[model samples]
Target: MDISPTLIGFIGFGILLVFLAFRMTIGYGMLALGFVGFLIVAGWNDALGLLQNVPFHTMFDYDMAILPLFVVMGFFCYYSGISEDLYYTVHRWIGQIRGGMAMATVGACAGFAAVSGSGMATAATMATVALPEMRKYGYADSLATGCIAAGGTIGSLIPPSIAMIIYCVITEQSVGTMFIAGFIPGIM
Candidate 1:
């Protein structure tokens, strides 16, 4: 029996949902599902070829190099206390007024973003460095967490951003231009 491509797509999507529900990591699940789909749609040899080439190309891509470096830089910043120092410096500059701690969190996040370039890293780093200070000052939990979350998003817009690098690679855009363009909005 023959199956329409649309039906095959729906089946694949359903299987993906099942994989997700079963707590499989999305990356692995999608890779497995795509391999299976390729085996069905294109023969075994072609599917194997695709499996081999895709990973090779993805791993060797120049843009992909930046991701690991940024992550390591974030770790270095965290362990070396640079992120904490940034938070404290900003806090000192603005910690006198109401909601100042939250504002300082944002400023620190932006500074961290310049080095880290990943929102997750910025958020995690700031959570460790800023959360307790805000709590010590009697800031509400919701406000403190909200500010961190919002500030973390700045990493996606700042220079050296991993997200922008990935996007530039996929879209064939200039990474430097994208990073430069992100500065104004990222600061705001």
Candidate 2:
């Protein structure tokens, strides 16, 4: 049987629309598209074989376990009050400049980025801790918000960063070195 261009276009359009409308997770969207495409091209039997086998491989895959481990680490760090201590330590030292509050915000962000992997988490934590104080201290909203907003990037750049750690593991390099390398880049 011939594969029609019209059918291909229709399927592609359908997938795009579904993704745009629901904003489904990328992995799920890709899996759904792949399953459907396989079914269309190779028929039910082959697609069934793949569908049956893919889940087992994906679920039981060795590398997949790392995600939960890192997530747990981040949650434990937050819940254990590590982020708070970090913020307080930085505030104690630098909480007094014209941009002292802003500097403190940056320091807190840098500190939080050390333990956390997610940039969003770093930003959220810094905002929660610094925003109110900055507001109360007569700091400009733009500088307060902007510093915290930009400081979030530190999470991704700092050593022990989740992204950096992943890269080290994937490349079979030293994690310590990678983390140190991230220190300056993240700070700047």
Candidate 3:
């Protein structure tokens, strides 16, 4: 009685789902199942070789470096309180203009986006920093929130962006070229 390759593949997939359902850590579960599948499909030597080399290739990639640096910068920005300063600075410069507070929200959001390079973080920071000022100025909630939301989304498309870094890595494109392509579109 021979088990077909498709049957083995389906069995492995089911086991992976069970591991996930049982709250096994995703990385470990995938690693375990992957080794088993590879061992079966190829051989023990090949499976072991794969396990040995994959992490080295994944870790040494230049694009992986960007994420950690940005993460560190994000923590620093959060603790050093730069986001607050950004909003206040924009507010002082634009507060007198009609709809200036909302404009400030967008401007500050874009500024913070440069530092955080994450849409969710930029939006969160802008909401915390700008919501009150916009409220105090009697700006409509929809307009104020909408501006921040739009501005925050630009973070992923702008330079020093995490998304673009990963994208360039996966696509084997030039990071500088990708950034240049995204920059003007992000700003506009």
Candidate 4:
């Protein structure tokens, strides 16, 4: 029986929601659902062939290599105390003003983003470094977490951004140009 793509998509989305509601990791849920969907659509031989080839090609792709390097660099910065230094430097510069802590958080996040490139890494690192200070200063939980979350998103737009790298690779665009284009918007 032939199934329309729309129907399949709706069904898949419903299943994904159920998976999410069950607290399954979204990545694993999507991967499993996608594999099952592909297998159903393409039959076993093609599905198996896809599974075999995709990882090999993805692993060897030159642009893809940058992802791991960025992640490692983030770890290095975190461990070496660079991220803390950045936060403190920004905090010192602005910590006196009311709501200055939030501004400092954004500034630190921007600085870290210039190097880190991954939003998840930036958020995790900043949360570890900034959250405590915010709490100690009596900052509200929502404001503390919200600013960090907002700041972390800057990583995706700043230079060396992993998101930009992936986008450039997929679109056959110049990574350098995209990075340059992102700077003004990312900072603002």
Candidate 5:
């Protein structure tokens, strides 16, 4: 049996929608679609041959290694008490004034954003590390939690962001220029 590339493309899109609807992990969804598309385009035998080699090459890839390292670093910051110190330091320095604790939370989050790339991960980590202390201080729930959530989002916008850096590298542009360009937009 033979398949038209157009038909195969449509099938791939349908599968992609189904996977997304089912909430499969994005990376695994992409991998599955890519594999299916490869089989349709180049035949099952060739696709299998490539897959056998590709997984090994991809896993051992040095460039991609940074992704796991960053994830580990963020997780470590949460579990190893580093995040706790950061929040407390900010809290002690600025938690007295009206809205000062919230401000300090934002500041500390911006500082931590320098190290973490993923906004959601940063927010989750901050909540774990900061929420309890903020609550214990009689801080209002809405203010404390909202500030932490907003602060975490800064990780996605701040310079040295993985997305911004990767975009600049892929476009053959300077990372410094990309950082500068994003700074104004981020703060706006």
Candidate 6:
């Protein structure tokens, strides 16, 4: 009555796909199925210990705490109208230069990236705030979208990013040092 670990893994993966197809949240589905597979392959005690301890260590660690804080900051920036203010200020400053609107979009995205900490969110926010303005100025489709896509990626490279925070936690590196390290690359 023993199941191989490989077989359990395949079953878990299959269930994960089925859950995803049914529109379940990917993280939750994978977590539940992973635990189920662990219980079947290892034993009830090991599975229970994993369920009890992994989340505690992963989330309760002080270094990992910054991850949720940065995520919240991103939402705060989005909701506080700061993203729009930044776009307008940068736009007015550079609107007259050749390709200035696109540059301004990049600048605004960088500014927002500091607070948002999420690339996709940063891009979506910048696109919403900057795209129409660029369109009004007769900017081309590819150029505007390109600026947005590029700018969005800066969130991960900048400080207080969820990705960076996760990396620091997983590698047991200093969160502050990692944040500082990301700044130079993010700017270029």
| Candidate whose TM-score is highest | 1
Clashes by residue pair, model 3: none
Q: List the residue pairs that clash in candidate 5.
A: none
lDDT of each: 0.92, 0.77, 0.85, 0.93, 0.79, 0.86
Tell me how candidate 6 scores on lDDT: 0.86
Per-residue CA lDDT of candidate 4, range 1-188, in tens? Answer: 88888998999999999999999999899988988989988999998898899989988988888899999999999999999999999999999999999999989998898898999899999999999999999999999999999999999989899999999999989988999999999888
Clashing pairs in 6: none
Q: List the residue pairs that clash in candidate 1.
A: none
TM-score of each: 0.92, 0.72, 0.76, 0.84, 0.72, 0.85
Give me the overall lDDT of model 2.
0.77
Worst 10 residues of 3 by lDDT: 70-79
Instruction: Identify the runs in model 5 with alpha carbons over 4 angstroms from their true place.
Output: 1-11, 19-29, 165-188
Clashes per candidate, residues 3 or more apart or on different chains: 0, 0, 0, 0, 0, 0
Relative to the true structure, candidate 3 reaches a TM of: 0.76
Candidate 2 deviant stretches above 4 angstroms: 1-14, 22-27, 38-46, 53-63, 165-184
Better of 2 and 6 by TM-score: 6
Model 3 global lDDT (CA atoms, 0 to 1): 0.85
Model 4 backbone overlap count: 0
lDDT tens readout by residue for model 2, 17-59 = 7886898887778788888888987999999999999789756
Ranking by lDDT: 4, 1, 6, 3, 5, 2
Clashing pairs in 4: none
Error of 1 at 59 (Å): 0.6
